[model samples]
Target: MPETSLVTARERAVALLGGEPDDATLRRYLHGIPGVDAVGLEQRAAGLGTRSIKTSSKAWALDRIISLIDLTTLEGADTPGKVRSLVAKAVNPDPADATTPRVAAVCVYGDMVPYAVEALGDAHGDPDAGGVSVAAVATAFPSGRASLEIKLADTAEAVAAGADEIDMVIDRGAFLAGRYGLVFDQIAAVKQACLRPDGTSASLKVILETGELVTYDNVRRASWLSILAGGDFIKTSTGKVQPAATLPVTLLMLEVVRDWHLLTGQRIGVKPAGGIRASKDAVKYLVTVAETVGEEWLQPHLFRFGASSLLNDVLLQRQKLRTGHYSGADYVTID
Candidate 1:
């Protein structure tokens, strides 16, 4: 939109939020955005899923999917050895095939950041630099029930431990209770906490846990709230929730990102985490990104898939494409 257009979605957003928004301003801004068209969104997402990828395109998609994965291991039993293994996978992905592209990052809990960083060594820096990044889950991941002080501390510790990115979960309870201000403040504060002792800050990915969000409209609101609060990426889940990362939910988020770009010329990242285990399913999400927000978002900086078993499936599919048949279980690692 033209800067001088006077009336745009962003301008409306600014006006709704006011200067330092109170509860009324928060509700007004969040509730003011266009409500989701549930049926239309779902049908469009399904249509995108059915779109075909030819042989050559499928090969390219397979590699692109590999590059876009945030190979994750977020469990209570997570060990340093497991994190190193995850890092090794992120750095190599398929050891037999040297040509196989490395993944974007290895996501682990905050305490494991050091191990992930240690294992990555010099190969851990920037994803765009042909290196793997270490992402840490913080802010009471998948729960977001802790105090703001604790949440900020969680993010700070991850950044201090050399995490390249911080995936912080928002408080679904507060969001569901219509406490938009509380959620907004928490996100904004966490974003600040991502800043390092040095000038550079770790990129913050806000997890909405869309499964608990209940409605598409709620997802839309949470996406906007995350961006407006300075989130580097709006994520769909923490991999602990059910019904995570559906095509329709991801499509809705991409639409919001598309609109944000059009309105303000700012491109925000989107991540669909969990429940996406198949190569075919991952390809569908790739198609959705291209169709919804354009192929520019196909890059690692703009899109990511959070999954533990997803890389295994992508690797198996890659081997099949090369040898014309599925490989044995040994071809991929067990997460």
Candidate 2:
């Protein structure tokens, strides 16, 4: 086949799966996936971390980082007022500065989706506007210990409540127990539940929660498993785990997405959640995306940072770039 035809064929095959997999077939596929080399992966990540981005480029990256944030608040004590405030912050990250770009999405718990949708309506004319997608964490979020039925319902409720994106967690217990098929099927089912009554489906982000996975090889396997099961984005963590979203873990995920695109002609996204607090750390992630997967994944459609405090630090950096001095916490909203 011609190269173009081959690419088209692979895309067609991937689209047919729609994020679910046939049990036996998916199991066989999972078994065939190769493992990762811990030393090589960590060395590459460390080397990439050493690349210095200059002043102008750093300013450009700060702006892009602002746009890529999935400003999140997934606490049990979350209230409607808190969700509304977060929605406001997501719509306008910097009230004092008009040049600052809006975040990619506002991620909240399933129950808060309605409140976020309502609050965001005044900010943007359409709920599905590209400026800020309302993402909800479902599937027993943070811990994927719920039954499959409850998890699917959790996803459906979020979608029905007006979420444009669904971030679901994979069952680490099942994965660790060698029940790859169960993990694959649960993600597939949740992906299907993301469909709205109007036939549109919210983008599905499968959170691997790499902190619990314990090894680079497991992370690689989970990343590929999520992709083959129809995940639009493979996320690094739920932000609840201790070692969430480290450089090496995220680097492995970036490599997987890059390789998946090469093999399937489908481009999946990556989000590194938890512990990515500083502007410098965010810039390092952007550098990884640019170097590992090229500039195409630099956009919000293919990349995201699932963070809350990272936004304010990014705002501070943006201010520094604009006025040549550091800004205080009072300059940015306290969401």
Candidate 3:
């Protein structure tokens, strides 16, 4: 396929972001959304310990967990070393501080995957070491405004450079303009490029940037469309928007996947990125999956938390449970 025109694509993406939604559609998206209930959400977030233990055991035993921890702290150019250390910590967790769950993979921007892959390679001797998969953000990430060819080549290069997973954002503009076929074709092409040189395929995660879509109906339609178009996972955001990943939005996507699975007998994954900072917040997302998507999606293959700061709180909470002391500075900062 020829490269899409970048100038045109960017204009289309922006227009879609600013478009209006009608009444019934707006109502559907807002369905059952509680009053921004963080307290209630936290109350529902009680199972982090059980979830973490389950993740560790499943990963150790059946390798069912995604065992994921993400790093998209793109500060300056000195990021390679930072990412390498982050990956290392996720694998060989600090023994003194037992809060970090064994992550299944280390995810970074496309430019940083090679550094993480090398670090993970150095730490490959540990049993914890084997779970180190790599995921790279592609397709003009936070803003899905790149040409289709650039997106495909971006995915291809990441896979070739050793990313075990490719997370691409759907062109929300196309979907908003009622061009579902264009969006679908773009995703399919990228999925094709995600294939390894020898014909194996890396996991392909499609980020809908749900907040950008701005309505529940759009979120639902995008979710369903993404799954039908061959998305192995449907992610919530680029973590760069005002409303990155919200429970209500995730709830909507959960329904889409639930119905999709019922209809097609195929399970798709969910990733809620952006604004997920605290360990409690991460657990809330897991609880949402467990309650809405069923106990099965709680495992990593069907679920993952995409955040840079979340691991520390998870680790801190874990340490408090294990050693009975709330020692601060238990984890290294991503910055």
Highest TM-score model number: 1
Tens-digit lDDT string for candidate 2 (169-272) = 99999888778778876877787787766666788899999999998878888898887667889999999998999988999999988888887677899999
Candidate 1: stretches off by over 4 Å: 1-16, 326-335
Q: Compute the lDDT of residue 109 as modeled in candidate 2.
A: 95
Stretches of model 2 off by over 4 angstroms after superposition: 1-28, 122-130, 326-335
From the highest lDDT down, the ranking of the candidates is 1, 2, 3
Error of 1 at 201 (Å): 1.0
**Residue 32 deviation, candidate 1, in Å?**
1.4
State each candidate's clash count. Answer: 0, 2, 8
TM-score head-to-head 2 vs 3, winner: 2
TM-score of 1: 0.92
Provide the lDDT at 266 for model 3. 68
CA lDDT for candidate 1: 0.84
- Candidate 2 residue-wise lDDT at 165: 88
- Residue 6 error for model 1, in Å? 25
Q: What is the lDDT of residue 18 in candidate 1?
A: 75
Q: How close is candidate 2 to the true structure, as a TM-score?
A: 0.89
Over 1-335, each residue of candidate 1 has an lDDT whose tens digit, in order, gives 11112123234446547755445777888899989999999999989887866644767888999989999999999999988888888888888999999899999999999999999998987777678888999998879889999998989999999998999999999989988878877877787787666557788889999999999999999998887777779999988889889999999999999998897677889999999998888888988999989999988789999989988888888888789785323232211
